[model samples]
Target: MLDFRHISAARRLVPVLLIALALAGTTAHAASGPGASSKGLRLAAMLGSQDAAKRAKGLSALRAWGQESLPGLLAAMEAPSAEVRRGAVMGAALQPAPALAMESLLNALGDPDATVRSLAAHTLARLGPLAATDVARLLASPTHDIRVAAALCLSRMGPDAVPALAAMMRRDDPPVQANAAWLLGGMGSDALPAAPALIHALDTDDTRLIHVIAEALDLIGPDAATVLREMTLISARGNRPFSRMGAAAAPTLVKLLSRPGTPMGQMALFTLARMGDQAKPALQDALATGTEGQRAAAALLLTGIDPNMAHTLPEDLRRTLGGAIHLN
Candidate 1:
């Protein structure tokens, strides 16, 4: 019988030689003449190559082998060395159907090594909406690297992942909540549905989560207005979070420039005043497009920001704040 140590060594040499020599290599000769077991060995060895060129050659060879390379790649994932396991992960990515390899990749996402887990996540992310739930679950993993990998993957899934991420925010699990906020922010405008959740997230005592939510709001920008028209219905205990968002919360506040005495208007005035120059663009937009009262309010609010905007306001629209309302 062939020596076990030699078989392991042969598996390495076989694939490399197969790249240059093809039929001349011992493993290639073995692969060509016989049962799929021999060919599988050839495949695993090639894919497990330490060299990128050889691994790429292995991937090309895998594409040519079509579905035939799968069993061997699956078995290779169980190998003791991380290198071989990574090779198997890459090889599985070649399969046309995600279903064929998803189970294995999911298992791989839990691999002790972060690199292997990340590779699995990237592969899953390529499936678009199909892999969203699986990746979202990883946000709860004890491993920070895995959580980051999962967040980045879900961000790439577009709006398909917004619900899963928004649901994560409701759990009060700080790490998961934080990662979800970061992912939603990365999704930008597509994550608008989660804006209210992100807005309410400021109730957290966790400073890290608070900062993350703020940053996400900044990235989501004007879309924070999704909650604007309904702002009267939300609790008014604090406007700190809205003000914390810098310019991003401006659009929502601009809506309130017309209604002076209302709770929402008071909150908007205080928050917009605090934003200074950051609130300039939205106020300028309002000046250009708002109703007469809105343009008047925007001009009055802008007086604190731009001395000339007050000059641009018609004498009637330039009137001061109403006595009935007080800035919060």
Candidate 2:
């Protein structure tokens, strides 16, 4: 019954009118009560929309909601759509605190989608101690990637992760052991309790692991004295060549100046000199009774620790150190 030309014009105008209405509604929503709630609902609905652009917008909006939107975001993690699940996990990560979302994020670690699981692990790491309860479970995951993710997360948790990381040091898997050592080393003095396991791992024939263990020991700082003493005893007893042991045990080597100048002592002196003031006390003791080589080495170490101190050394020691420094 309508004219064909009029009908065609109306059809074209329909899309234009819809777009104008959408814009007007958005503006009105920005200025009214219940607007925020309506907008949140719209975004939440878009999370499951088939359109990728709509889903992206939804995720952005939810992230802006932060803690306020956590409940809905956590609920969305179980959505049938992988894209929606991904968006929800990301949105949950944006919360100011882990809050009630910790369990949801941990559960997401087992998401069927690898990307989602990885994002979940990264988010958990950001949550720090809020997610500590899952550390053991994540470390025990059958999947290698998940284990790696857990280790990486623990590495950033500082002292709080010491117990879990120390336990991981004894894992039969070489990669797990290596990662634990690396993380413990990065934790510095906080990882002191893990020293025994790290020291024992040094006996392994695995050359690569030996380096990691040594670094962890070094980071355990002065508390490593007992292990260092044992290492010195082993080296002196000819259990291992000095060359094989000197570099890893450098921090303790300075303390051994009271002993005779073996190859280990020579290497220790060299190592100490390179360590600056950390070696001062040991170097001073070396000057008191060390052989000419040891005294010279101590003087040279003093030069690096403090050139003024080196100049103040007894004339004879300075002369000897000067001659040896040039050669070194």
Clash numbers, per candidate: 0, 0
Model 1 root mean square deviation, Cα atoms: 13.7
User: Model 1 over residues 3-83: C-alpha lDDT tens digits?
Assistant: 123223433443343344233222221224265545555566666676655655666667677777777778777777787
Off by over 4 Å in 1: 1-42, 51-57, 158-160, 203-207, 229-328
Tell me the whole-model lDDT of each prediction, alpha carbons only: 0.65, 0.59
- Cα-lDDT of candidate 1: 0.65
lDDT of 2 by residue, 1-328 (tens): 0112332343344334323322322111111125544443455455545565665555556545656666666767877767667656655555677556888877776778765665666667666666754764476677765665565557546677777677776666665677678778877888887776765555554546655666566666634345655554433434454433343444345444423344334445555665566567767766786657557666777777776776567788766566554422
Question: Which candidate should be chosen as best, given lDDT against the real structure?
Answer: 1
Name the 10 consecutive residues with the lowest summed lDDT in model 1.
Answer: 22-31
Q: Candidate 2: list runs displaced more than 4 Å.
A: 1-68, 112-114, 158-160, 170-175, 186-193, 200-212, 218-226, 229-328
